[model samples]
Target: MLNEEQAIEARATLEELHVEHRDLDLVIDHLLLSPPPDELLVRRLKKRKLLLKDRINQLESALEPDVKA
Candidate 1:
């Protein structure tokens, strides 16, 4: 469970990452459409996007209250 301040920080980070992820998607799409696309760079950007997605999910989970089983 995050305190109020921590939760606020997490939410801000999440929003930032979401914007970045969306930007990466646009870049990737443009790369795909352009002739002679650099496969290596595209792959690297995709990997980074995946990492950001994982981090976003992790933060979202942290913001949620834990349930006792």
Candidate 2:
């Protein structure tokens, strides 16, 4: 189980990552609609989206403190 400070930090980090995910989603949507999308831009967006997803998962896991077996 996490202490109070640790839990707070985890929650804050999770919120930040969630916000970043939302921003990335918007960028992806815009890129999808744009005609003749730039290859580099598309690649960057995909990479960022993947990274954000991993980070979000990590943060979410941290937020859920596990009970000791």
For candidate 1, write residues 1-69 as lDDT tens digits: 899999999999999999999999999999999998999999999999999999999999999999899
* Cα lDDT tens digits for candidate 2, 15-37: 88788878878887788789876
Instruction: Candidate 1: give the clashing pairs.
Output: none
Q: What are the clash counts of all predictions, listed in order?
A: 0, 0
Provide the TM-score for each candidate, comma-separated.
0.95, 0.80
Model 2, total clashes? 0
Clashing pairs in 2: none
- Model 2 CA deviation exceeding 4 Å by range: 67-69
